[model samples]
Target: MKRILTTFALCSAMIAGSASLPLHAADAVSNTSAEKVLPLNQRMAKKSPEWLSRGIMYQINPRAYTPEGTLKAAEAKLKDLADLGMTIVYLCPVFVADDDMNREFWSPRQKKSQMDSPLNPYRMKDFYHVDPEYGTDADLKSYVDTAHKLGLRVMLDMVYLHCGPTAVLIDKNPNFVKRNKDGKIITGPWKYPLLNFESPELREYLFQNMEQWVRDYGVDGFRMDVADGVPLDFWEAARVRLEKLNPEIGLLAEGTRKENQLKAFDLSYGWPFSGPVRKVFVGGASAKSIRDSKEGFRKARPIGGDRIIHFIDNHDISNDDYENRTEERYGEKGVNAALAMMFTLDGTPMLYCGQEICDKNRHSIFGSKFGCTINWANAGSEEAKRRQELLRSLIETRNSRPELTFGELIWLDNSAESDVVTYLRKLDGKQTLVLVNCRAKPVSVDVTLPDGVKRHFDLKDYEFVIE
Candidate 1:
């Protein structure tokens, strides 16, 4: 929920100015520079094919996915997902929860209409077994197989920072938990108990159990939750073991920090970009500030490293929106523009489960969370269909264009009155200029291009090439 990066060092000059604040770059060069060229072979060697390089990830909330809310039913929609052009599918949690049993176990309100059974699936009841409500272990395998059949890789949400006090593992293996100064084991967050990664037995058990998920289910990787809470040593060890199992497997960290970027993870959340991007779109934050912050992160990356995962909405954002935001803030057009920003820029972009259909309802699942279902009836609506179609086109374009997939990025400077952000990505001998107008008024500005060849990419119709 919180950001992990605190360092404020200027690392690169490729960051352009936006509305947030004017970022000055003394040595900034034009988009057509020799250093701005990336080779496809080199990028493949450095980034690997399994890291969702140029791929799109779609987030699925199992509980809220359907009225039935079972793995079987969820799996039935794999075709619908793949049809949307999502290559990577990420499900929140599959393991049974300690709290999902009673019909009203999770909902505090107790109102039948507002209440769904209690199930914080992420709070593990048993790492080795799947929750019956969600489905059986074999069902999980089926889901994985089905996803692979559709050409989609699955990333399970790993919540290892802590577990429910009543977790079966707690009673079966007391050593799996963190201990206080008294040498007594603690359990649950309410009890301030956490997994003691320092203990040899605990460490071995956690690592093996996690590795088992990959081995048994044929899962691609883990989207580690609260990754910052865990130490680097644990991650380094897990990375080593997991890599041994499948080197091409992907690892996504929820926490994004410079210290965690030491090759242990394939990609991490792009908070540095997400935070500023949200502010700029809502008019609370300036595009200039967002660009400067992103520049700071890019400056820190080594020559060849894992790309960052960029997005405007996720479980975190949706949950937070329940508290202080509204669907109006991210209306249909606004959300689409945000998607365009994520897709055109560097790194893999994530689409939250119901984003395509425009689920405006903001409710948390922590309590009697609405368990808001995707409006399937609206699936055929013009707005929903259009968004999905646009997403498909962008994804297809990204997959086809080597330059967009692994190209070097150079942000172009527009005038102070400009509300549009322009940048270029280049690889091989090909190059593309992406200009996104974030304003209501029509923008008329001269954009410099490589070899003085300016091409305009219209976000409205998904068009490119300068006039």
Candidate 2:
């Protein structure tokens, strides 16, 4: 879920600054530029599917999702996800990883070993086949089918920006790759070959590959990786071509581009909000910082700010984060509060795999090692069951209460003190109000409601209420 193009900026602003958020929280824009607006027809070609708009997205790293590490095993858990009330299941790239570490590569982990690791799902070796390590081609199809049967849409994550060193495309079609002035291959980090967008045939090849996933595997859409590296024109053209095959197919981008970027896709990641929320609940920032940052995002994209997917924990932040995972940083109780706000606040919320169980083991971003896989035992444990119930109830409210999902946001004036922040959401003649306490100690706050109920109340730290 974390397809970070500017990891340094995110690491500095989120992980390091988690202890104390800077005053200007929304200034952290990645690969930012003045956007040239597109024509009205292209800008509003499609609205995000209603199911997706109201749904809470869940990111699944199939490799480490369970002990079996196969799609069949993942298929078995479809009912569990359905019970959690998740509407979307986004699986990381099922494509083969470069098993041949014969070529040179360097990981951000600072390790100098020349060994093969299947941890990085962003690198692809073959687009046609599902990773044998994960499962056979049939296994993936079955997984997607099961998701659909359980009333969940599946988004297959695609790594289209670059390919692994031993990627089949490197030698199979040299014309499809980016090359330097001297004619040698242009290499990104880890010596992976960058794709040449200028090649029409290459673009066509990718478009068809995308179609195969939807047509053959029965996936609903794709969660594109490093979308910023690919030209905007290419994406718009690709969307036009692919939608013919399935108009309902949604396109989700990982980068944090502005209005022009949103024109080509249905959704984008709200990564900028990550650190500020942590700053409020776990770090020392005030509750007002959350409102300030969200307001900044709203100003930037007045048309479709809610399309950005928001989350407390995702694959990148949970697995290979520069700082500790959300569980460790926020602790168990703090996680509940952070997630509660994520579900009730702006945009479509997301939950990373294993979060329901409060999974604590951190896997290497490069690959999973001993003792790092998700603990299935927690799935039936009391703590995990409690979280499942909490998440289910939150999602139930989000769906049952239209104001919670599609309402206009209005911060309650002076309704909260330093430790608490309250806001009201209104839509379709209904209103929903939320109050969250980020403090660790119980405190009383004077607050007024729309129904003329005004009172002071005490709340435990990281507690919240929706009315």
Candidate 3:
């Protein structure tokens, strides 16, 4: 029997007026009348910074971003990213990684890198120092400074749940790490020692490290890795202290916990929607699956202010293998359709380093031993230039139109729900219609809006239109 997941209506009633309500009153309204409930769009705008809503995020794996694989080299590309319409540049971990070449155990992915001395970026040896492989403290400061000058916000990937066995924290205070009944340190999925959040000393040390990034490096925000592994209270406390330094500091949780947004984070990963999205294009899933997954997420996380970060590719996905890349699995045209849905949907969208040019090379983070550096040479190719233009235009459209950013997403019923997805983004009396063909063939869809106006679309393979 095919299990049916509870899904939201495809043609739900349009969200009505609640525009003037203050963001601070979200809690009070929830306790009051249903009619006074704040809409999702307004709540998001109220909770997050205006620039965040209008901006697109670009994830840069420093190891693969440039041939040099150093902070100095990556700094040179800030203007190019800004020119490409990216307002946020999220860098993967650059902290001093464990270089214990004699370590017996290695994860499968690490083994794939085939490095004699693997330096997985996630395995941190010291929280305060930059990995010599990437650059020095001064280089990091310059990178952040350069990004700010180019009108881009830099967010550092923080691996807080676990650290390399020889981390300074463990050496300073062995009790800072969690241990089993036998008094052996507990190892996480990546074979790194897990930090004991219960230790107040450990908590204080990690909190201070975060403050250093903001104060010394002038980082605009942090993307917390394996955030769910840590206690929510810890994140809440960290946010309080960090906000005292920079009120506009953003927190993006790598976990799907909805409550992360209530206070600790500005956005959570849209893991549920990502799978169905990929299936629609590559696995021949119904277009309705996309709608179903999104509605499922909304139902599970009913908070109006909650937001998600949507992406088709990121460091983890790309490093897994070349065949897993969106461009590799579905080709450029299919990637275009996926990108359209990602950017147009009611959430913040993210792009991996080479996604704008549709680069299909795998970017391994363990090391460059497997020849995993991004192929910048591909950027000069004609096909890459065309895809770049498409991405740039999509970002420009999203940034210029406020409705697309915080708009109420109202799914419209269409004749070809199996292959076509239709919706409207309505905000402040303005509405933008979006039609997407999820399949790689011609789709004829007849969509009817809430106002009873019907429109016909002859969408070519994986094509999308926004008007």
Candidate 4:
């Protein structure tokens, strides 16, 4: 229980800067973080690059983003994403996808086999090679280089838990995979075989490959899928090794386990917290529920909560099903309300591709039998243009003002209505009053502000107002 740069501390160092003591420095207190929470600035006088705290990441599936569905094609949109206030561009799996397992899946025209399901990007065929469909290794380098030029960091999608049914490891080193009682390889729900992390050789293999992505492609971060499935010891050991190679590179875990944030990962998705935010708009949820949820999450954090990745829709959640789409599930206004909550909360925000334009289609990177690519033409349409501007404004509010990203919440009285939630984000002498009406219909409630503070109160259905 001595001073140590645990994963939590590393994440804080990337956000709160040198002012933050190493996470384990509080040896006298419980490791669960018994210390009293302080205001954003007071908690740490220094701050990391503004991008880490105010970061807004836009996720793109290279194979589903542009009609060409290649890294080169997606590179053309980097500047646009940057303009949208995205400091990080996360590409969903650029490595070679398992073609052997997808022989039955057809290509765009029903002319050839696509060889894989969009739901299974984790089934990698090669740890080092870029997918033929996603262009050559040079294309990935160019993509990362373009993002860097735009002042953007590139986060690669990594899947270490498993490989494709026909991965080379399955043949060359079958011992690296898990075997069932029947001596058959154990597979996940998607039929993808699982890797055996107990094997030191396998761990080294994955570690070296992840290192290659950072060193070779200059990737700034890695979004590991199903991180909890891997042994915590391995993640911790690998993190120590990887960070020594490049201290600035970051690691993001797709899992929700809070303990994962305490040690091995720099960031983890706030999957549990996201449910309450989305439910608040779906009706039946009260303002108290949202307040309680946010407060609890803030208090429960073992380190800087800013490391949490908040998002309304992601590649995995933004499925092809209508019920899962941002437009159909939450609608434009609901999506905006969610954004208001997500950005104003203590976390790094993320925007899925087409989310800025209120894109209706869910991302289906690879066709099971037919093609379903994003229509690039939407970026030019009138509705898309409006949404783009709206999205830009929402993110700018978070990035331009330190209070929004680092502020402590001062919940305001909203007893007048259950459908409405109001609060103030105050820090560094700046304050932003956020009022959100979670109902499907407009609510006109008379609101009283603190002395010398002023804001508009009239709210439309599912409208989020920041003043």
Q: Which candidate, 2 or 4, has the higher TM-score?
A: 2
- Output the lDDT of residue 20, model 2: 16
Locate the minimum summed-lDDT window of 10 residues in model 4: 6-15
TM-score of each: 0.81, 0.85, 0.90, 0.81
Candidate 4 per-residue lDDT, tens place, 1-467, comes to 11111000000000110121222221232223332354322232112334555578888876557778888889998998877778998888878767663533322322222424433456677878888887899999998998899999988888888888778777768878899888888876556778998788898888888888888888887888888888878887877777777776667888755456555676677675566666665545665566665555445345453256777677666543423566666666666666667776656788888777767754565442244556566768886776676667677677776776776556665443466666666776777766667667766655545553434455666766667
Candidate 1 stretches with Cα past 4 Å from truth are: 1-51, 100-118, 183-192, 323-327, 367-371, 448-467
RMSD of each: 9.0, 7.8, 6.4, 8.6
lDDT of 2: 0.68
lDDT, candidate 1, at 437: 50
Best by lDDT: 3
Residues 275-361, model 3: lDDT tens digits: 777777777777777777666655534355446777877888787765456677877777777777777777788988988777877
Greater-TM-score candidate between 2 and 3: 3
Residue by residue across 150-210, what tens digits does model 1's lDDT show? Answer: 9999989988887765677778777778777897766543332477777777778789987
lDDT of 2 at 339: 70
What residue pairs are clashing in model 3? none
> For candidate 2, what is the total of clashing residue pairs?
2
lDDT values, one for every candidate: 0.63, 0.68, 0.76, 0.65
